[model samples]
Every structure is written in structure tokens, then in C-alpha cells.
Target chain A: MRYVLFLYAAIAFVVLAAGSIILPDWAMFLFAMALAKGLVCLGIVAMMRGGVVSFGQGLYYCIGAYTATLAANMWGLSDIFLLTLLSSAVCLIVGVIFGPMLATYRGIFFAMLTLALSMVLYGTLSKMSVLGGSDGLNIAPPTFLGWAPEGRDLQTALYIYVVAIVVIAGTLMRIYFDSEQGLITLATRDNELRVEYLGASVRKVMAYNYIFAAVLGGLGGTIAVLALGHVDPEFAFWTTSGEFVFVAILAGYMSVPAVFVAAIILEVVRSFSNLYFPNTWQLSLGIFLLIVIVTLPNGLGSLLSRRKGGKT
Target chain B: MSAGVLEVRDVQKTFGAVTAAKDISVSVPKGAIYSLIGSNGAGKTTFVNMVTGYIKPDSGEINFGSRNIAGLAPRLITRLGIHRSFQIAQLCNELTVEENMLLAGAIHHDERPSFFRHAHSAAARERAMATLERFHIAEHRNRLIPELSGGVKKLLDIAMAMAGETQVMLLDEPTSGVAADEKFPIMDLVIEALRAEGVTVIFVEHDMDIVTRYSERVLAFYDGQIIADDTPDEVLLDEKVQRYVTGGPA
Candidate 1:
């Protein structure tokens, strides 16, 4: 495990060095967004693996973003890092508390229940005048400690991005999938009765996964809000949650890196299409999603596994 | 590991106005293969659900091993060494077989929610593989649950339960829809694997031959009550049990 970490750090150091010299701001932005999106999707992957399809991740993401916003503005906090941690703590608490209810449901109902919760959050947030009501609040330039964050907040964003990508996508999740509880989550999904008799509590497993998803969503949302310098009730809206699910499908559920790659590609496509076609880009996006769904049953991650198996 | 004893005392359950289970009490000791046989709507599933902590009984108390586990969280019961497999295998058809094992593995992996703690250590993977190998389908480790045959999927489903490495297991009709020829081998494998590990199993089934073959004792549920609870041969010979099972003793 330590060796994997060391290797990861070495590779990241090399990439950051390369990015600093070669990539432009736009490319860096894409990378950062992709990484954040991937982490968020990974949480969804965790949830989905347990036979759940949550449409409420947007609520966690928005909570993460606004909690940081609330921390920075209400408390005059200077450390962006601390705010990130603060947001994560909040999401974890909420996830652990409400996750069981979500886990109790299954199939389309599960999806709808998550969407309903997120919408409830959105409705509540939109009504709060203190949260800038409908217009949303301007996010202040977040500084790390006392150091006036260097070179176009993008660099700061990029740094946070790299950290999120490495930690969120690393061997922890890989090893988790190998662990006893991880296997139970799948068992719980496949056969709750079997899991129960085996002396595993499916509820606990599902709750933990849901909480993990919340933490990831919160982390990603907080960073994205800080990057965009604004957050609105829309952060909790179903559409945002829907977007995460859509991204998960595009990347397929299992591939952690594919999710990041897909996120960047989605953003790039949206940006380029908007620039070129203006109005019909959504159509293009829909078509692309359809293609992936039809072509890849397991999504992009299956390809990597299939290749690895073939080589072996 | 704490004696693997399960005690349910005077447990009564009502769904709104309908009585699902009534004054039911049974105790399963460690290292016992207990079989529950009943007709449809006999409350076998309901009884198991209550014990698993999915639903609270209107009355009575349940002691799992030494702990009073009545109406506790299902996951908590699981942590205390109780696991189950549904009648038709309820796996997430979308995930790979290995990934399926993982969802359960993560929680049992540690007490903390550390995503950074790589669960894919040599120890975890080897354990998961060993679990699959125990079920005799380790070769199909990479296949998706939906792609496997009903028998194979059933085996994998049981493998997921084994993933938690629990001592007590609950199965609902472990051989429900398989070819008749496959039933004996499946039960044989399940019984052998679980017994070799010293795991106790309690299952519900309509197959009398299976009960006679694998169970040390037979529990008969009729109208939500255990009308007959005894050694398989004893239960088979009892007049009332004969009436309940075949309308009259042959």
C-alpha cells in the first residue's frame, strides 16, 4: 500500500511538473473539473454497486459548496483547506444519518427518493434569503492559509484537483472492494437475505456506502464552487444530480479513471458544441450518451479489465 | 464466534391487522443445519425478516448468541455474525462478480470509513478468492452475476455471504428454480463448504428430500407458527406434521 502511494506521488509529481510547463489554463481547468467529477462519480459508483441509483448526490455537492461558502463568508475563514474539511464533515454527518432511508428502497423508487430529497433541499435553499435567494452569491477568491493563492485561482484549483483525484481514485477504494464489508455491499445488493444469514448487516453496509458517496459529492461540490466563485440552490437541484448519474453511465460504473476522463470529455464536448452550434449542443450530448449506453454495457472500465485479463 | 446461538422467544408479528407470525419461539445452536419447511404464506420469510432486524416484532425478544438483538439494525446483527441469501439471489446485476463481493467487503474491512485504506491488499483479495474457491466456482470469478446460469449465480450468491466470513447463515430456498438434477449437488456443495468452516446454516425450503438429506432438525411453519420442531426423522414421523405437509399421514 505504501509503495502504491509512493508510486502515485511520483507519477503525480511528474504530471504536475509537465502540466506547469506545457498545458494552458483551459486545459488545466478541464483536468481539474474532470478529476472532481470523477470523484463524485466514484461515490455514485459505490452507491450503484449496492443496487442503488441515487439522484440526490446534487444535494451533497451543493451542501459541500454552500457550506464552504457559508464558512468563508460568515466566519471570514482564510484557509480554503479548512473549509474543504468542514464541508466534508457536514456531508459525512448528513449522509450517515439519512443513508439508511435511501438504502431501504430499491430500483426506480430508490432513484426517485434520492431525487425527492435533493429537490427538498433545493426548495429549502432557494427560499432562504440569507443564501442570496435565487441570484446566488459571488464566491470570494479562497486563499490557502495566509498565502495569497498564486497564479489565477486555476493553479489552486488544479492543485486541489490533483489531490482529490489521487486520494479519491487510489488503492483505498480498490482495496475496499476487496475487503469483507465491500463484498457484503454487493451481496446485500444481490441477495439481502443471504447477506443477513451470513451475519453481515446489509443496512450498515449500505449506510456506509451512502455516507461515503455524500463525502465525495460534498468534497467535489465544495471545490467546484470555490473554482466557479459562486453557488446557488441549483447546486441541490435534480438536474445537477442527474448530470452526475449521466456522467456515471458515460464512464460506466466500475472504472474510477474512466469517470474522470468521461467528465473532461463531456465538459469539452459541451464547451466546443456550445461555441460552434450554440443551441443544439444538448442534442449532441444526448446522442453521445446514447451511443455509450448502447455500446458499453459495463462502461469504459470493463475495457481495462478485459484487456488486463486477456494479457494475463 | 460467541457460541453462534440464536434464541427467539414468544415472538409475535402483525402486519397492520393480519397476523404474520404468532407466538413463535425457536433457538438454533452453533454448528446446526436447521431447515424450515412450510407452505406459501406460512410466515417463514416474515419470521426470518424479524430476526434479521428488518422489521420489529409486535412482541417477544430475540437473543443472537448471548446478546439481546430484538429489533436492532440489520447491519448490526450482521456485524454480530448473521448473514443471509435471498430465494432468487438479489445481486446487483450491473456489477462484476468480484465487485459484487467487494460491496460487502468494504464495511467488514474496517470499523472506520477511511476511503484511503486500500481494501485490495493481498490479504483481502486472497480471502475473497479463497471464498469463491470454497464455493467451487472460482473460475467464474470475473463473470457478471446476470450472465451466469441460475445454479452458478446461486453459488456466487452464497459466495457473497461467505465474503463476510460469518458463522451463521440464512438462506431462502437455496434451490428454488434450478434443474432437479442440480439441487442435490448445490445443497451438497453448500452444506460441505459451510460445515467445513464450522458455519451454522438455517434455510427455508419446500423440498422435503433436501430437508431430510441436509438438516439435523426440521422446523415446520404453518399459519405463522412452528407446529413441529424436532429431529428430521422425528418431524417426518409426527402425525400433525404429516397432516400439515400432506394433509394426512401416509
Candidate 2:
């Protein structure tokens, strides 16, 4: 059954990629950006499963983006793979440094602490002229192992690259969600005391989850910066973090694939609402969230499960 | 105290002006079913908390098998062969009973705790199922936590702790929320299971019948002090216990 689902996902991804070749350039760009944002939602889902709702994942996101952009500008390192590795490594270090503080909080305290940290980053980024300040830095177009795309081919390459990365991430994430650490992390959300009593270190587990979330956030930001060709202070803003949270809630922590679906849905909704309502996109999102909260408290992921009352 | 597997000496804790525990000392022998009985606010739970390393005493020594573990983290204490079941039944409300059991089994038995290994590895699943079967909760293994009865939840709570290398098990109000008629059966299964594993069991219970029926040794607490400590019959018959605890000699 699992293999069949994987095969189905592969076929769907192939279809999506094939379809993207014929689609308009703007649509392809939007799709890539959505997939990039989806990566951030994946991290949010992981943290939420561990009883944490970070309001500052954008901190790591911004860090990842800046690290990639800065590394390119300073060291002339523009390889996609190298940038991904560097971003993840930098975020892991940041996560470890912040792990102790994150471990000391839970619930709203954790949420607020995370928000404060992100705001600090935003404030710093906005003031640093070397980083282009509020204007931020523009990232050089990335090459795949030395093969740089030219003009129209850039969109095609990026679109395919994102699809492949999202697929790999989604597949790996599914396995992770089924792994021992994932189960324990999810269990901690319900009862930290019981988890501790069972012989697992709650603080250690939270730290691990925090780092994992940070790595994901960093990866997502790296992808976003590469796709958009720009990295900015606004990427670390509380509202940006709130947007990730919004997608996570829309996606639910039930399954890994939900994150991608939620991100795409969010982007599509935002684009349509921005075009149609102009001034009421936020209002539209708020209403959508209110409805999801009321009708499907577990988020859209619950819709995939046939088992009633079985929490994902 | 030489023969005791778990020992507490001169433990004292005070929250503000209220003394939750004062000069509390007790020794629990290996493979013994020890019960602590007291009224509400009598520091029974506080004693359990201190022993389990949930709360640190201002001054005391808690030695589990020769190691002084007074201020250790709860996980370290638990890893040192002491496990606890909460009074309110601390469990993963979003997970199934078997999942909870498997989590306990994996944490307690798997030292490396691999991220690659599936949580329900064959060994873990079998162990979880066996533990559930031992507690007569096999029927509810697949059920979500909130679906189980209070008696079943209480039993599962204790049963989950059995997954660990439990040399000493502390149970706080094991039968508190359970139905009166189902209490003894749950306690009987719990005691039998622990005895089979040679676990030294220390439980804080308010029910006199449970204390008398299950405990080999009973410690009666009054005003944050052990007013009586003896065999069940002797502790139950003490005048201090009679007046303050049992409301008169039975």
C-alpha cells in the first residue's frame, strides 16, 4: 500500500512537471515559490507535532537565505548543492545555540519567545547596510553542478529542480514521521511528563525537534532566495513567520504531503485574492482559517484520513 | 536501609510557609509492595514526587541502589531503574494505547534510540502487546487514549511503566479515578505484574481497602510526617491513624 502511494506520487509529480513545461512563465514561477514555501510548512508541522508552534521560524529562514546570498557574494559559491548544505549547516548551529532557550518554554511562552527572536533578527537585518538593509541583497542565479541556465531555460530548470527537491523532501519526511523519534516527538505534544517518565529526555527531544525545524526552515529559505533572486529583512518579520504558521494550520500535522498541498493552496488563494479583492486578502485568509478551525479542527490533513476520531 | 533498594533520608521541602514534607524518611526493600496512605494535602504526593525526582527536597538524600539521586533530572532518575505513573494518568492523548506502550518500551529498552528505526519495530510491537496483555488491556490496545475507560487508563498508565527496567515503581493515586468495584482487580493485576518482575512498588493511595488488600507494608502520613509505619494491620490499628486517617479503629 505504501509503495502504491509512492508510485502514485511519482506519477503525479511527473504529470505536474510535464504540465509545467506548457504552462505560462508566471504560473511556473508561482509554482516554484509555492513549493519553496511548502518546505517551511514542513518544518512547522514537525515542530507542531512536538508540541511547539514557533512564531519565528522565519529567523532561520532569513538566516538560511542570507547565508546562501552572502556566501555567493563573498566567496563566489553559487552551486545549488553547496548552498543547500551551507544553509542547513549554518541553521543547525543557530538551532543548537537557541535550543537551550527554546527548551525552557512551552505553549504560548514558546510561541512568544520565538516571535521575539525573529523580531530581533528583523530589526538587525533592517539596520545592517552591508546586508543591503531593508532593500536586502539580490542572489546570483544558481548553477547546477556548474551548468547555469540561460534565459527561458532558467524557469524550466528551477521548476523541475523544486519539484524534485519537494518530492525527495516529502518522501523522506514521511519516513521520518513514521520513525521512532517522530512518534516520540508527537507524543511529547500530549504529555511531556509521561514522555520523561518513560525514560526519554523531554528537553533533549525538544532540542532535536527544534534543530530539525530550523534545518527545514533554512532549506526552505535557501530555495526561496534562489527562486526569487532576492533576500530581505521582511523574510524574518513576525508576519512572515505568521504566514508559515497559517500554512501549517491549514495543512495540519497529520501527514507530510499536507504541507505541500497547504502551501500551494495558500499561494493560489493569495494570488487570486490579491488580484480580485486587493485590500482584503488578509480578511479572506482569516475567514478561511476560521472556517478550517471550526469545521476541521485538525486542518486539511484530516480530510485525507478515513478513520473518524483517529487523530493524526 | 542496607537491604532497601530505594531509600529516602531526612528529606525536607517547604513551599512558602507550607511544609509539604518535613524530616521524611523511609526505606523500601526489593520486591516489596509498599503503600503510602494519607488524606488530601497530607504530603503523600509530595513524598512520591521527591522520590521520583519531580520535586527537589531542600535537604535530603534519595538513594536508589547506592546512588544519591536527590536533585537529578526526572529522565535520569527514571533511567536509573525507577519509573512513575501519574495521579492524573499522564499519557499521550493523541496516540493509541499500543502506540503509548510502544513508546515506553522503545525508550526504556532501546538505549541508542535510533531515528531510523520504526517506532513499532517487531520487537517493540510484541513487547507493547505483551505488556497490554499482561494488564488485561489487550482489547483496548488499538483504541485511542480518550476511548479507554478510567479503570483501563489507570491500568494502562501503570502497565506503560512496566515497559522500563523498573527496579522501583511509584504510583500516585493509581485507583483514584477508577470505579470502586474495578479498583481491586486493577490493583491485583498491577501488583502481580510488578511482583513477577521483582519491582519494588511504592504507591500513594487514599483507598483503605486497596492499601489493606495489596500492600505488604503501609506508611501512614499525617501533617507531612509519617505518623505510622508497619505491616498493614499494625498501621491500620494505630491510634494516630485511627483518629486522623481512618476516622476511628475499624
lDDT of 2: 0.87
Q: What C-alpha RMSD separates each model from the true structure?
A: 5.0, 2.0
Query: How well does candidate 1 score on lDDT at residue A49?
Result: 69
Maximum-TM-score candidate: 2
Candidate 1 structure quality by residue, lDDT tens digits, A1-312:
567645765675566546645677777766666666667777888887677878878989988889999898899874777888899999999998888877778889888988898999899888889889876777787776666665655475445545544454444565565455565565566666655544455677788888889998988887787767789999888888888998887776555557666777888988899999899999999998888877776676767554333211
- The lowest-lDDT stretch of 10 consecutive residues in candidate 1 chain A is A303-312
The DockQ figures for the candidates are 0.29, 0.77
Local error of candidate 2 at A312, Å? 3.7
lDDT of 1 by residue, B20-88 (tens): 899998878888999998788888999878877788998998987678888887767777777777788
Model 2 clashing residue pairs (backbone): none
Off by over 4 Å in 1: A1-13, A30-39, A67-76, A90-131, A149-181, A230-238, A306-312, B1-120, B125-244, B247-250
lDDT of 2 by residue, B1-250 (tens): 2399988999999999999998999888888889998889899999989888899999989998879999898889988888889899988888899998888877876575767677877878998898889899999887888888999999889988878778999999999889889988888888888888888899988888788899999999988999999999999999999998889875
Chain A in model 1: its TM-score? 0.91
Q: TM-score, each model?
A: 0.76, 0.95
